[model samples]
Every structure is written in structure tokens, then in C-alpha cells.
Target: MSTVLAAVGAVHPLAAATVNDNTPWVGPGMMGFLIVVVIGLVTWFLGKSMTKQLRKLDAGRAEQQEAEGEEEAEAAAPAPAHDPKLNGAH
Candidate 1:
């Protein structure tokens, strides 16, 4: 296995060897571009998801506030229950 690997490494040049030695920036530039594209996609998707969640939270909050308002209105109304012990009629 070691001999085979040595022969292969000695005979086959790397794919990059075909490019000009003076052109050092090409590989690094392509990697940077790919990184930026991936980051941009992630940021865009995250922003869209966050906005959707925020809208849902706002809607839920509004519904809760409306229900609380209705409960507050009920609290101010008079109670009409009559107890027999309080009226000395038991």
C-alpha cells in the first residue's frame, strides 16, 4: 500500500499544477465568493423566519389584550346573587 501510494503521488501532479504559478489569487477568491454566497443565503432565510415569527407573536399578543379588555369590562358590572343568611330568611 505504501509503495502504491508513493508511485501514485510521484507520477500524478495535483490539479492545481496546471494553472500558472503567478495566479495565486484565483483559488482563494473562489473560496471567498462561495463563503459569502452561503452566508448571504443563511442571513436572508433567518431574517425572513424572524419576521414571520414576530408577526405571529404580535397577532397573539393582540388577541390576548382584547380578551383581557373584555374581562376588565365584566369586572365593573354589578353582582345580583342574594344570600338567605344575610337577609335573615333561612
Candidate 2:
């Protein structure tokens, strides 16, 4: 068993040498890098678009809240309910 294992180990380098950079598998390996780069660019663009949309939504909500606050302030602060006999307006 030891002799057979040693023989296989000795032939491993020779077997690996038979395949060069020009092998068919190299093309798909190169395509893997391209696919990663393409996906990264797509994700970056998508994140940018989503961030812009969220910012716009936040600004709209802030404006709506500010307007509603103004209306509530107006309604809650009306003419003072003073004693009519004291003011002589009764």
C-alpha cells in the first residue's frame, strides 16, 4: 500500500503538467471573474438607485409632517378664553 501511494504521488506532478493555461477550463475560470465584476456593478447601481429613492421619500415625509404640525398649532392656539366681565366685551 505504501509503495502504491508513493507511485501515485510521484506521477501527480506529471499529470498536472499535461494541462496548460491554454486548457478549455481556463476560459470558464476567466468568465467567473467577469461574472463577479458584472454582478458587483449591477449591485452598486441598484444600491445607488434605492438610496436616492429612500432619500426622496424621507424628504417628502418630512415636508408632510411639517405642514401637519403647522395646522395643529393653528387649531390648538385660538383666541384666549378670558372672562367676558373683566374684558368688558360681553
Candidate 3:
């Protein structure tokens, strides 16, 4: 245990010499903030574009459905019966 203690004591000075208090520590600054803002703006724009496209798609589908309903109603209706009296044929 004494030898282990002596070894640890010898290494402490080397460890203390490697550390410098004068060097500055830097964090995520303006560039990081700009990147995050750009990402948020891109996401917002994409969402708006997707909503516009979905609205257009819904409008087209409604128009198509209306046209199909009209066609079906026309095809289902029967023709009027012929009337000779009304035509003045006796």
C-alpha cells in the first residue's frame, strides 16, 4: 500500500502540470442559433406547402365526386312515356 501511495503521489504533479487555467472554454454561439432558426423556418415552410397541396387535392376530389354523382343520377332516371293525344295524333 505504501508503494501504491508513492506512485500516486508522483503522478499528481504531472497531471497538475498538464492543466492550464488561461485557456478559454467555448460553447455553441451565434452560428448554432442561426442553424436552429434556419431549420425551424424550413420546417414551417414545408408544413405550409403540404397544407396547401392537401387543400387543392381535397377540392379536386370534391369536384370529381360531384360530377360522378350527376352522371349516376342521369343514368338512373327513366325516360318520359310517349303520349299521342298530347301530340295531336288522336
Candidate 4:
């Protein structure tokens, strides 16, 4: 174990590789820009579709609520009164 430790300690650290200053550094070119544009357009279309769907859902819910309100009103209204004479009750 001590011999292994000594051997490990004797090893020197490697130096980093050098880069050429003459070479130009290239970045993400036209392809990256096209990809971003496509993604943006797709996202915009999806958002529009989602908005349309949500509006439909909201309209349906409103109609359902209106129908329920009418039903409740009908249930709560008082019935027509009957005359005693009409039923032969004097």
C-alpha cells in the first residue's frame, strides 16, 4: 500500500492542451436560427389552437349554467292556485 502511494505521489500532473489563435471560433450558424424559428411558429400555432379549445369549453359551460339556472327557476316558481268552486267544494 505504501509503495503504491509513493508511486502515485511520484506521478506529475499533465498540462492542458494549447489552442491555435489563428483559427476562427465558429458558432451556431443559419441552421440553429431556422430551428428556433420553426419551434416558435409551432408554439404559436399550438397556443392559438389551445385558446380556441378553451373558448369552446367556456361557451359550453356558460350554456350549461344557463340551462341549470332555468331549471332551478322553474322548480322554485309557485304553482297556479285552484278555485274551490271549480272542484265542486262550495
Candidate maximizing TM-score: 4
Q: Rank the candidate models, highest lDDT first.
A: 3, 2, 1, 4
Model 2, CA-based lDDT: 0.81
Q: Model 4: runs farther than 4 Å from truth?
A: 1-15, 18-21, 82-90
C-alpha lDDT of candidate 3 relative to the true structure: 0.84
**Taking the tens digit of each residue's C-alpha lDDT, what string does model 3 give over 2-86?**
5655565588955443452357778789999999999999999999999999999999999999999999999999978899999
Q: Model 1 over residues 34-84: C-alpha lDDT tens digits? A: 999999999999999999999999999999999999999899878878989
Clashing pairs in 4: none
Alpha-carbon runs more than 4 Å astray in model 1: 1-27, 80-90
Higher-scoring candidate on TM-score, 2 or 3? 3
- Give TM per candidate: 0.57, 0.57, 0.63, 0.68
Worst 10 residues of 2 by lDDT: 15-24
List the RMSD of every prediction in angstroms: 7.9, 6.5, 7.1, 8.0
lDDT of each: 0.81, 0.81, 0.84, 0.80
- How far residue 85's Cα lies from its native spot in candidate 2, in Å, is 16
Q: Give one clash count per candidate, in the order shown.
A: 0, 0, 0, 0
**lDDT by residue for model 2 (21-89), tens:** 365553657789999999999999999999999999999999999999999999988777778799788
